[model samples]
Each structure stands twice: as C-alpha cells, then as structure tokens.
Target: MNSDAPRPSPRAIASLLVLSCIVGLNTVDRNMLGLLLPQIQQEIHISDMMLGVLMGPAFMIVYSVCSLPIAWLADRTSRRGIIVCGLTFWSLVTAATGFAQNLVQLLAARIGLGMGEASNMAPASALIGDTFGGRYRVLAMAVFAAGGPVAIMICYPIIGRITAEQGWRAAYAFMGLAGLGVATLTLLIVRESRVDPAHGKAGTPVATQAASGIWRATRQVAGTPGFALLCLASVMVSVNFGAMLAWLPSFMVRLRGLDTATTGALLGTYKGLVGVAGSIAGGLIVTGLMRFDQRWLAWAPMLFCLGIIPAELMLLFADAPSWWHIGLAADTLLMSAITPCLFALLLSLLDSGLRATGVALYLLIFNLVGQSIGPLAVGMINDQLSAAWGTAALRSSLLIAPLSAAAGAALLLALAARLDTSQAAPG
Candidate 1:
C-alpha cells in the first residue's frame, strides 16, 4: 500500500465481505452440476464423457472467451454496476436450468451461466485490489478464496437432500433463488471506489500506456515478473481442481455406495470446514512468513502441490473408509491452502489498472485448457476402461488428479526459482 493512501475504511471491509459472498455464490453455481451429476445422468442418460464436457468445456468455453472483454470493460467502468448485472443475469440463468428438458437446453443454460459469471471474478478481484492494500490485500484475497468452501459447507447438504427428494431441478431452483437474494444485498451494501482506474489514479498504470490500448496493457501484464510461470503453473494446478470438483462427489457415491444425499452431507462437512480453515491459514502463513523470505509466497504453493499427490493416491486406492478419509481431508486442506497464494502472488505483481485484465487472461487459460482437459480427459479415460474394469475405471481415470499435482509442482518449482532473483514481498 502507498503511504499516502487512506486506510481501508469500514465500507471497504463491507465491500470485501460482499465480494466474498459473490465468490461463494459463483462457486456454488459452478459446482452445483457436479453434486447433481448422478441424478442428472440417471434421468438424462448422459455418458461419462458428456459429463466431463458439461463440467468443463460447456461452461468454460464461454467463460474463458468472455472474461477478457468483460474485464476490459470493468477496468474502465463501474465494477459495482457490472457485478450487480452479472449476479442478476446468472441467478436467472441458474433458475432456468431447472426448466431444461434435454441436454441441449441444459448446455445452453450452462453457457449462459458461464457468460454471466465471466463478468464477476476479474472485476471483483480488481475491486479488492482497489479497496484494500498491503497485508490486508492478501488477507482480502484469502477471504475471497474461502468463499467457495464456505458455500459448499453450507449449501451441499441442503442441495443434496433437495436433489434426492425434491429432484435435481429443485436444487437448481433453490440455488438460483439464494443467488438472487445475494444480488439484491450487493446492491444495497457495497460501494464502488471514487478513484477511476481509467483516469491515471495514484496506484494505477501510466496514462500514456493506458491510452495506447489493450495491447499495451496486455504487454505490460504479460511482462510482469513470474507471469509466464504463474500462468503455466495455474494451468497445471487447475487440472487437479477441474477433475476433483467435477468428479469427487460422484467418486464417493460409486466407490462407497453412499447415496448423493449422504455423499453431499459428508463432503459438505469435510471439505468445507477444512477448506475454510486452510484458506485462512495459507493467508496468515504467507503474510507472517513473507516478512522474512518474501519467496514464501512461491514456496508455500510448490510444497503444497507436491504434498497433494500422495494424499490423492491415498484417497483413491485405500479401502478403509477412515484411511481414505484422511487422504480426502489432507488433499482438501493442502489444495485449499495453496489457492489463495496464487491470487496474492499474481495480484502483487500487476498494477492496479492492469489487475482485472491480467487475472482474466491468467484464468482464461487456466480454465480453457487445464480445466477443459481435466474432466473431459478423465471421463474419456473412464469410458474406454469401463467395460473391462467396471467402477474400477473411475479409479484409474482419477489418477490424473495426482499426476496433475506432480506436473504443477514442477511448474511451481520453476516459478519459485525464478522468484529467487526478485526481492519484493507479495501483498
């Protein structure tokens, strides 16, 4: 934070809370299909490969394509306005999912949901950068990151019961209604910053460069230290995220013979509680440790990625429910803890004006390529092996989860080594 900048005010804290809620809500909509997948598959006869597509490309294609343009608009406009509109639009689209009679309708609704969500993340991240600074900035990002876990913890059990009893459509209806309420709350509570990003504010990029167009901003963001390494590592880590988010609940159902309702209830408590704690812990750890070796920002994630591989394997093959449960909890803790570091590291590297566009670019590739491959490839693997192995095919397919962690660890190692040359601490 610049010494001249005003302290983060009460309203600033309030805005962070609102944005964090939006993050949680966005996560719920994205992961909703995952929890509802088994039911949908039984009713609609979607193959495993199609489940992968619906989870990955069907949603991400639109999200990745739209994010940069919408983020460009956000950087130069009222971020609060865009957020309000996105919330309403996506909430409505989410409600419409309940009405889909076929795969085509569901796909269309997913695409619309993606389009609406594309508007929020980049802009909301930029708002966090604008509203909070220094140590608080990293802490704010942690709060934002925890939103997903918090949402799942609170929502999964209810959604599970709704899906099991009232049907999947009812679960979608409940999520959409809850989202609409949050959107209204956002309009009432959050305030946009007075300093305009476009007018060369104190903490923003140079005006001449800004006037040079998006290409210049692109070049600047691309040139950020560790930007390439961060983007590459982001892709690798996201592979694990996509695979787990899309399939983990289904895996529990298939392997343990737990119903969706029961599975959701267990995972909700397990992943959600541990996840929230880990997210906060990572921020605190990074903030405290970076006061010594600023490279702790890079080091923390690299170590966590390596740790996740073994945990994932234990989760996959171990027969004792208690045994594998430890793996599940460990992977969730390590993965959740590391996620906030990415946001902190990247946000620390970019200028305030460039934050939205830059993060959008990073996320575009992370979701477009890595997330797309994780589910679709795993599903294809499962399909090819299903005849010979039966439910065992899913275990074979999910090895991608651990393999991805190894790959991510390698990429993050390169990032940490590269960061060895820089002396700056991430915010």
Candidate 2:
C-alpha cells in the first residue's frame, strides 16, 4: 500500500455503498428483461430465437461497444460524473421500456439502456480499487459483487408480483423510476479522488504505458499467458452463467408448471441469501488461502466451476420442483463464489493506472462473446429441438450450460498452471 494513500473514511464508505447500489440497479435493469421475458414474448408475439436476441445481443452489443470509450473517459476524468450521467440515462431509458409497443421500440430502448450501463463496471471497479487498500480490497470487491444477487433477490418478488397484477411494463417503469433517486444520491454524495502527483507525470513509466490507448493496453494485458487464459475462462463461465440466468424463470414456468410469482420468490431468495453468502465466504476463503498460496485464486474458481456442472445437470433434468430449487440454489452458491475470486485475480494482474481499461476490456469480451451469444445459442437450440423434444427442448437446450461450465473449469485449471502466484500482486 502507498504510504501517502489516505485511510478509509466515512465518506469513502458511503461512496462504496452508493456505488454498490448503482451496480445493483444496473443488474436489476438488465436482468429484469429476462425475468419478464415470458410476458414480453406474449405481448410482442416473438419466437424464442427473437426473445434470445432481445435478451442478449440487443443490449450487449451496444454495451460492449460503448464500454471501452466510456471506461477510457473514466480513466482520464471524473468517474463520479460518468456514473451520474450513466445512472440518469439508463434509468430514463429503462422507464421508457414500459412505453414500448413493439419489438423495434423495445430493442431501441434496450440499446439505450445498454449504452447507459456501459459506463458502470469499469469505472466503478477503478473507483473501488482507488478507495480500498490491500487485504481489505478483495473483501470490498466481494461486497461490490454482492450487488447483482442482492438486486435479483429484491427485484424478483417485487417485479414478479407486479407483473402478475399490473404488467411487466409497470414493473419496468417502477424499477426505472426508482433508479433516478439512487442517481441523485450518488451525485450529491460521491467525491472523486485526486490522483497522486507522481502518477500524473507523463514521464512516469506507468503513465506512459497506460496512455498508450485502449487497444495497446488490451494487447499488453493479453500478452500475458495467464491473463489471457483467465479471460477465456471468464467467457466460458459467463456463457453458462448468463444463459442459465436468462432462461431459468421461463424454464421453471414452462417446464415445471410453476407460476411466475413462485419462480421469482424461489429464485430471489436463493440468489439473495445464498448467493450473497457464497460471495462473501468465497472472498474470505480465497483471501485467507492467498496468504499461504495465491494459486488458490484460480484453484478456488476452478473447483466451483466443476461443482456447477453436476448441480446444473441435476437442475435441468430433474422432475420435482423441490429438486429443481435445490439444484438451482446449489448452482448459485457455487457460481457466486467465482465472481469475487476472478475479479480479484484480474485486478491483481494490473496496475492502478490501467485497472479501468483492463476491466473494460475483460467486460467487453464477457459481454460480446458470453452475453451476446449464450442466450441466443440456447434459444436457437430450443427452437431447433422443439419439433422433436417439444417442452423438453428447453431442458435439452440448457445442457449447453453444464458443458460450458466444464470447459470453464478446464480453462481455469490451465490458467492456474501459467500464473506465478508469488508475483500475482498488482504492478
């Protein structure tokens, strides 16, 4: 830790809390589309493949494309300002989704939502890195990663009940409007940190390196064998995780004959409670293990990825709802453990100056390849198999998730071999 870096203050803690809420809001806005997919499909009269497109590529393409530039701006300027603008923009666009009458309108709204959310992760990750120091850093990141599961927990039941009574549009409107308040709070409370004078000098090697532009930074990061493998592992894990998240509610409703409300309550509780527990536990366990052997960073996620394959398989093939819930909970628990560990590893590989760009590049790959293709692939598979398998098509289509998890486990194991754990600390 830099001796000159200020100790954590109340304002810094409040800023992290605000940032976590922003992350949670982003997750709710993005995942709510998937939660409301069945309703949206009925109203728009779209095919499963089109629903997949709407869920995946519609938002992700814009998000992936815009994230790099927005992240670049954050690396150079005010991250707080970027977040305020993004929060406001996405909130309005999310609310506008309620007014969409057709596929084109919905798609446009989603594109705007994606553009807005593109400002989130990279800048937020950089801010968190700047805010917290060693030892506390991983735990802080775990808390940050908890935002998604926490959002899912809160949104699922509320949105589910609202969709049941009012409509999916109303749910979208309600959540969207609520986000503006968070944005307002963030604007009022969060303050940007001043860069160290030494860090600002162009003559400094770190500054010169980070100033080389996005592609150059990307290439330099990719040049590392371990980091490249970690990215590949991330893509595989995200494909499995993203596909399951997008399709799980519909699968439960259609295949298990559960009501939307039931599906929401069940998943919400599981992700909220179990998921948060797993993230924190995983962060603590990995942080403890890092003191002995930093190789546990990759090994922990590898083990979790392997655990996901069997749990997901059981979830997909099971006949009983209880069995399904159990499988889902187990899967969520294991998968939740991966986020903090993987992010900690990624941050550990980069310097503070390039962390935002590195995170942006990683997110670009994750969204572009994983988020963009995963759901689409599942939907395509479901459509193709429907003629023969009927309702079972969805179940069979989900087999891809477990297979992707297996690949992720393999990739992580490979990544562990290449990483030099002793030198894994941030440059």
Candidate 3:
C-alpha cells in the first residue's frame, strides 16, 4: 500500500501506538501540575491569578509559539527523532520542576516543559494521518487520542500519592524519571517512515525547507473552509476544556466537600475510563457516519452540545441532592466524551503533510484565545461572585459550560453549510 492511501496494516497499528503514547504522556505530564498546584501554592505564596496564569498563559505562550516551527520541522524531518527528543526534553524538565526555589523559577521550568510538550502533538498527529488514511484513520486517531484518558487514569493517582506523602518535589522527580524511560523506549522503537516527495528530498536542510513549508501549509489550510471551521470549533472547545481542567477539581472539592484524595481519584476514574470509552466511541461513530455521509462534521458538535446539558446541570444545581458524587462523576464522563469527535473531524479534513502545521495553528489559536483566557476569566468570576454567593460562585461561573457548547455547535453547523456551499461552487 502507498503511504498516502487508506489501508489497514501492521504499520498503521504501530503508528497508532506511538501517537497514543505521545498524547498520553503529554496529557499526564501537563496535568501533574494541576494535582500538585495546591502544594506549590502553599510553598510559594502565589495568588490564584498567578496560579491560573502559570497553568494557562505562562506555559501556553511557549507551547503555542513553538508548535508551528516544530511542526514545520516534523513535516520535513524525522518525526520519530523529533518526538523522542521532545519526550526527553519535557520529561527532564518535569523532573527538574522539583528543584524550583521560587514562583519565577517554577514558572520558568513550566515554560521549558511547555516547549517540550509542544513538540510531540503536531508531528505525532501528522504521522498518524499518513499511516492510516480514510475511515480507518478516525479509529486510529481515536485509539491514539485515547491515550490522554489512559494516562490520566495511570498518572493522576501516582502523582496524587507522591504529592500527598513525598512532597510535590518528589512527584516532579518521579515524573521526570518516568518520562526519561519512555523517551529511551521511543528512541529505540519508533521507526521513521519515508518522507513524502512534496516535502522535498530528505537530505535538503530541514530548516530551509521548513520555513517555506510552514508558509505554504498555512496558506493551504487557511484557504480551506473545512480547516477554518475546525479551527473555530477548536477555540470554543478549548474554552470549555481550559476552564474545566483547570478549575473542576477545585470546584469539586470546594462544592462537594470531597477531600483531595477523593477528588483526584474521582477525576482519574471519570477522565480515565469514561474518557477512553468516549474517545473510542466518538472515533467509531464518526468512522461509521462518514461512510454514509461526510456531513457528520456539522452534526458532531451537536453531540457535544447535548453532552453539555447534563454537565452544566451537574456543575450548577446538582449540589442540592447531596448526590454531588454522582453529579461530579457524570459531569466528568460527559465532558471527556465530546472532544475526540471534534478532533477526528478536524484531522480528517487535511492531508498528511499539512496536518501537523494545521494542528499547530489550531493549538496556537486555541491556547491564545481560549486556554489563555478561559481559566483566568472563570477564576475572576468566581472571585467576584464568591463574596456574595460564597462557594456557590463556582456554580455560577461554570455557566460557560453550556453556553460554550451551544456556541460551538452553532459554529459547526455554519461550518458544514459553508463546506457544502464551497464544494458546490465552480472551480
């Protein structure tokens, strides 16, 4: 089978596993800070805004900024080497996070970690796109993307325990060591496939080619209607994602009266098992739906919107029943389910060479607009409302949940119509 064609083969599975590990490791490592934030706050005397910024903008700026260049390199260079190097860099930095003496130092370490983390996604996404084409690619994406949940399940508990007993520093050190091991394995096992001819001959300097390629890929995707809508949907999705991931555990503990251990465990459970199931389900659904009609891209966000209804209710009024446990658990499961479908649609819209840069552009906009603002915005709202509503303020601020979901669904619908209109237009 040609590299560009759709096929099911051993190469596809191998590529899927590698991308899965990349996604899984990045998600787990990034979230480790969330689990340890309270400890870091106590030790560092930082404000909530500062904490939010560190998790949001401070890391994201570097992560988002570097992604395009790294992705550009991935398109023209050895993706395996890029991924392995990225894994090693971030893992080492994650471990180095143990050594911070002040807020500035910790923030700096996170920036380095962000840069390293940025390297993995674009390249890995592109690799999977190349390995598995057409309908099968969606399932491969689902499987690979399922790594995020899998890592959450496996890593959260370990980080929680380490932070609880050994101190946050120990947790950092341990995460770093684990990352190092994974990095070594990646270097040894991930084989590089032949580069596409359009990427130019392999021996050409990657840096020179990457500069031209980045501009070209950006032009292609920017001009493509499907890509633009996906990017828009990504921003809305990030707003929902950033706010929840950053604040949800705190919300659960404060509102439901759960201890950190319980909150962490619950989060792990919902995000781990339910998230994995949702990703796989979304992939399968999209794969099946695309077989009959490609317009499911427009229909996809509606499912996301529907999921938000239960989620918002759980976040807001669900406190009344004293069944906050069930509400929180259910909310988490629903929250985790919608994203894989969104991503599957976006990935399918582009070809292999352009996918990474497209993903990078998506992440760049996603982090700058949504990830950068969403958490801080919610936190500020919580602060203002907290004085009046006290703990209940979190419930109010979480209104973003349903609202963002609805908006996203609308955007997706518009996008589908645009896509159809574009296809009908004469060349």
Candidate 4:
C-alpha cells in the first residue's frame, strides 16, 4: 500500500459507511445497559456492586479474552464473516438479555454479548486500513469511531422514552431486533478488501513461519517504548471513560435531580453532538499537524487530556443543572477528541500485517484495566462511601475519573517526548 494512495472510491465509502453503522449498533447495544441501569437495578433488586459486575467485568472479561483469537482469525480469514457472525450472535444475545428474570441470567447474557462484541474492533479497523489508504485512512477511521457517539445520539432518546413507557426489557429487545437488519446488510454488502501478501502468507502450508511471524510482530510492537507509553495513556483514558459510561446517568438522576428521559435527552444532544465534532476536529488537527511533525499525534491527545480534567472536576462539583450540563459537554468534547488521535498513533506503531493483532492486544490491556476494573472499582468506592456521603457518594466516587485523566495526560506527554518523528510507519 502506498502512503500517497488515491482517495477512497464510492464503493469503498459505501462499505465503510455500512461497517460504521454496524459499529454503531454494536455500541448502542453495549451502552444501552448503562442507560437502563437504574431501572434494571430497581427491578432486579441488585446492589451497586452487582450492577458493576454486569456492566464491567462480566462483559469486558469475555470481550477481552476472546478478542485475540478472533483477531487472529480475522488476520487470516474473511474479516467480513467474523463481523457478520459476531453481529448476528450478539444481537440475538441482547434479546435474550431482555428475557432474563434474575441477575445470574442477565450476567450470562451479558457474557454472551461480550463474546459477540469481541469480534468487532480489530477486524473492523483492519478492514478500514485496507479500504482507505494514506492520510484518508485516519479520517475514515475517525468516521468509524464516530459511530459510538452517533449511536448514543440516535438511541438514547428512543431507548429512554421506550424504557419510560414500555420498560427497559422492551428497549433491549427492540435494539436487538434492529441489529439483525444491520447484520443482514453487512453480510450482503460488505466485501473483504484484498489481503496483504504478508497476511496471505499466513495461510501457507508451513505453519512454523506463520507462528514465527506472529511472534516477531508481537515482539516488535512490545519493544516499542512509545507504544508502551501509548498503552499506559490508553488505559488511563479508558478508565475514565468506562467509569463515566457506567455511572454518569445514575449520577445525574440521583445528584442533579434529573429524570431518566431528561438525562438521556441532554446527554444525547449535548455530549453526543459535541463528541462527534471533537472526533472529527481531532482527526483533522492531528493529521494536519503530522504534516509538520509526527509528535503532534501524541501531543494533541495529551493537551486534550489535560484540558478535560478541569471540565470533569467542574461536573463533579457543579450545584446547578446548567453548570453540570456545561461541564459534561466540555468534558465529553475533550475526551472524545483523544480517541481518534490515540488510535491513529497506535496504527502507526506496527506493520500492516500485525495491525489487527496489535489492536486486539491494545484492546485486551485496555479492557482489562479500564473496562473490567474501572467501573467495578468505582462502584465499590461508591458503596464504601455511601454511609458517609449518602446521596453524594456517586458524585464523590467520580472524582477519581479526573485524576485518571490527569495521569493519562502525563503519559501522553511522555509518549510525545519519546516519539521518533522520522520513523513513521508505512501506510
């Protein structure tokens, strides 16, 4: 692949769009649990710690554990098939979640959901890299990344309202059924891009070379000091994000005195829109800055992380609803900006054949520290503080998120300082 490859064609763009939509649906199903957490807690009579288990460890453990094997398959097989099968399976499992009558059943369904989602990021990202070469690849990925916020924007109001009227179970079933449509479309429309010779060679009769190549690729990525710093930063940022996703809505409902509908609407419109803008802006800014100095990729996210800390602090302490909303919007904008830049930087750290496996490893570490532990830690903290803080326990528990962002900023700055600008990866 050429670094100066031509812009993606209409067919490529269409495929990207469909794949992005699938990504969006995947996010919507995953995040809907957060939106409906309060209701589910009320109905199931589970404690905060139990809710954290369902939202965090139960889902992330399976999601993280399965990612590598799935990514390995994706690297050697049809990426499209992996995505379609995962999508279809997860969607159906999400519907099964709606039928759960107890916490154990819900946990089981969530575990299945995690297994299904395990097939997504590595393959989807690999596909994007193959479809959109050169500088446009970053922008295309930013578009794909926008799917999460977009899903929130579209699903929040609809799911929130449905949960208010029809119940949380209905929201799950509806989202699950809707995903089946996306799965069908993906199966029909998304074709696999031509595999690189390095990847094709993995399928050769000699298994030793394939294993050796994978080992060498892993060693190469692991040996990169800058990539190590990036992963540290990613873990910190993911901690903040995971904690927020698990508890923010509940915080609003409890501390800010907003109902679920109002909370969803505000977040959907304000946070979602601002986040989408930030993602696009960050991609453009980082890519443009890379034209002058590649270090800007790490620096941009560092600055964003530093900026987000104050916004998050304000959100935690704000007394007025207007002030709280303002803080949330600002925090979300800065936080969202960091993702595209971080992902682009990660892609630049390794060879093309290792991209999917590299991403899976990144996600594995990210999910283990961030998704599996972050929310659970917060929940445990909230429970511990409840006696002293009462209704304010959740608010106080969230203070750790900003501290994580601060650590992330420091890590990013370290990464920027160490980044070798002249050793840019090939497209």
Q: Name the best candidate (by lDDT).
A: 1
Q: The CA-based lDDT of model 2 is what?
A: 0.84
Model 1 lDDT tens row, 61-177: 899989988887887888999999999999999999998888899899989999999988899988887776666777888988998888889999999999878999999999999
Order the candidate numbers by TM-score, best to worst: 1, 2, 4, 3
Window of ten residues with lowest summed lDDT in model 3: 418-427
Global Cα lDDT for candidate 3: 0.73
Ranking by lDDT: 1, 2, 4, 3
**What are the runs in model 3 whose C-alpha is more than 4 Å off?**
1-6, 194-213, 320-330, 421-427
Q: Cα miss at 283, model 3 (Å)?
A: 0.9
Evaluated at residue 416, the lDDT of candidate 3 is 71
Could you tell me every candidate's TM-score relative to the true structure?
Answer: 0.95, 0.95, 0.90, 0.94
**Which whole-number lDDT from 0 to 100 does residue 25 have in model 4?**
86
Residue pairs with backbone atoms closer than 3 Å in model 1 (clashes): none
In model 4, which residue pairs have backbone atoms overlapping below 3 Å? none
* Poorly placed runs, candidate 1 (over 4 Å): 1-7, 194-208, 420-424
What's the distance in Å from true for residue 374, model 2? 1.0
Report lDDT (CA) for all predictions.
0.85, 0.84, 0.73, 0.82
Q: Tens digit of lDDT per residue, candidate 4, span 1-427?
A: 2356676777788888888788888778887788888888888888888888888999998998899888877877789999999999999998888999998899999899999999999899888876666578778878888877887888888888999999999989898998899999987788766323444554643322433455565665577557777888999999999998888988888888888888888778865788788788888887787887878888999999899888988898987878777888889888878887888778767566667777888898899778777789888998899989997999888887998999999998888888777544436
